[model samples]
Target: MSVDGDPVSETPTIKEGTWEAIALASAVMLIVWMFIAAGWIILAGEIELAQKRTAVAAAFVTAGAAVVTFCTVIWRGKINERQTNTARDQLRATEEANWAKLLQDGAALVFDSQTGKQSAGLASLEAVVQTQHRLFAKQAMNLIADYLEQVHPTDHRSPLAIAAIDALGSGHSLGFQAARSLKFEGPNKDNKRFAPRSIWVPILGVRLVRYYGGRMDTQYPHFNEACRHSTFEKVYFSKASIKDMSDFESCFFRNCKIEEIGYMIQENTFQSCDFSGAVNFGIESIDDMPDLRPRNNFYWSDRPPIGVTEIDWASRIISVPSQFSNVFAGERLMTKEGRDFIADEVLNLQRHSN
Candidate 1:
């Protein structure tokens, strides 16, 4: 610039420190640029490494979740099996305990029976039967019947015997065998210690004896002898095969129903004995020789008679015949006309005898 013009020499005189200050500024800027480039490169490498580590961690987490799911399924199955086995064992143990208790109770009942405690024994037997153990109840019934027939023959009319009879009646099939062996006879003459006894036991469903091809008397020997002067209250003989009933006399029958008795009953006294359903003997003419009069002797009655009164058929003024209103009330074998005819015959006989 000074060589071109006249003011070149004056302009060529430089500023005091302008060139040095510019060089210093350029150096400082170059060092700053280098540092920035180096930092950017390091940061880029670190971000790439972090992304790889994150993918590896994600893979590990997914594998771990699958393992946990499989282990949980297996563990639950094992637990359920263990619980099922435990419940089965408990049920088996309970059944065993129940069986043991039943055996123990049966033994105890036998002991009571053998120790002369018949009332207590029968009560225990009844309790066992009420438990609905059919086999055990049947066995117990058989044992009691055998005991009564073999050991307690002379123990008729005892409260224990009565209870045993009631127990026997409650059974279905086992009672029949026991009832057959029962001896309902007058007392033995050799054993004067025993009173002149009758069968005070209340018999129910005696018609079942017919199934064994025999009448009640044939099945139970001396039954007629026991029936004499004995009160048979609420006895049922429905559809029974009674061939010969000639010995049924001097007995009191209350609310007894007879269906198909295979005989012409002529001598038996009926006191509320219902023959309306008696198909065989309903039309048979009853004989008057054996005193076919209603025996009012009873152990218990709804309408209890006053005092020790005997029903006298000799007098025309008599208590109303129980058979007229109760037994023969409906359309049965003994019609109203038949009843009237029989009554007139009885009155005529009474007058002739007097």
Candidate 2:
């Protein structure tokens, strides 16, 4: 009538009650039939036919009960499974909604007038990428890039632009069509655009370039890792610095002008790289040579700096530190043939330089 102190009114559905009643009636009838058969056997003195009939009836009753129990179990299992799937779907939807709201809030902060709020927005986007929310991060990156492209550059550092650059630098990969050209249009445009300054645009360890075609004019834009096979057609880099201090590094440059550049790294082969309009190279010594070390000592080591192996000829042209000299000497002297080979390559590069 009741279970666990709950009323029995809600316990049974129509189908469940029907099956329960059938089972109870069948059990009672089976007991009565057995007693009747026993009485008949005692009165009629061992009736074999009657015993066979009783056994057959008992088997049919047992089979019917088994079928009812099995159907009930299967129906309950299906109901439970449907409930579980519905719950999972609801949870997934809720999570997606939360992420969308977070992205909206971050975008609002980015466009805020306050510098602190803008920084917080950038930090939020960075957190998205760092946490492996690839879709959300990519969308945010595109929005930031577009905003940076539209805004005009100012004499003072623009916080929004800086934040955008920081976001782009933080990402491991980027995707967007490059701008056709970069120009400074306002008064003192030349000074603003081509000033002899050291601007920080650090993109240190990005390995993937989903899209890379742009007329970049930023000074001292650092690319310390591989950014090979991207085209820069008719780009201008007046007093710019490009450095790559790692192995198998390469990039592309086509019809680009350079007043003075510090290509102070090693083994960076520039494919189809042209420097027809380049100046300051005819001088005896170059100044403001770009250093290939990471900005902070947190990334520094005692290992010989980047261009050591590729620009081994620098030892002859400039003073070489004892540590680097020792390593180079040992490597060159590994065999008489190796020593001869290095000498020949160095001489070849020197001749070409002149």
The models' CA-based lDDT, in order, is: 0.42, 0.42
TM-score, every prediction: 0.39, 0.42
lDDT of 2 by residue, 49-95 (tens): 66776676667657755665665565565567668868966975675
Residue pairs clashing, model 2: none
The lDDT of model 1 is 0.42
- Given candidate 2, what's the lDDT at residue 314? 36
Residue 196's C-alpha lDDT in candidate 2? 27
Which residue pairs clash within candidate 1? 2-8
Kindly provide the TM-score of model 1 when superposed on the true structure, using C-alpha atoms. 0.39
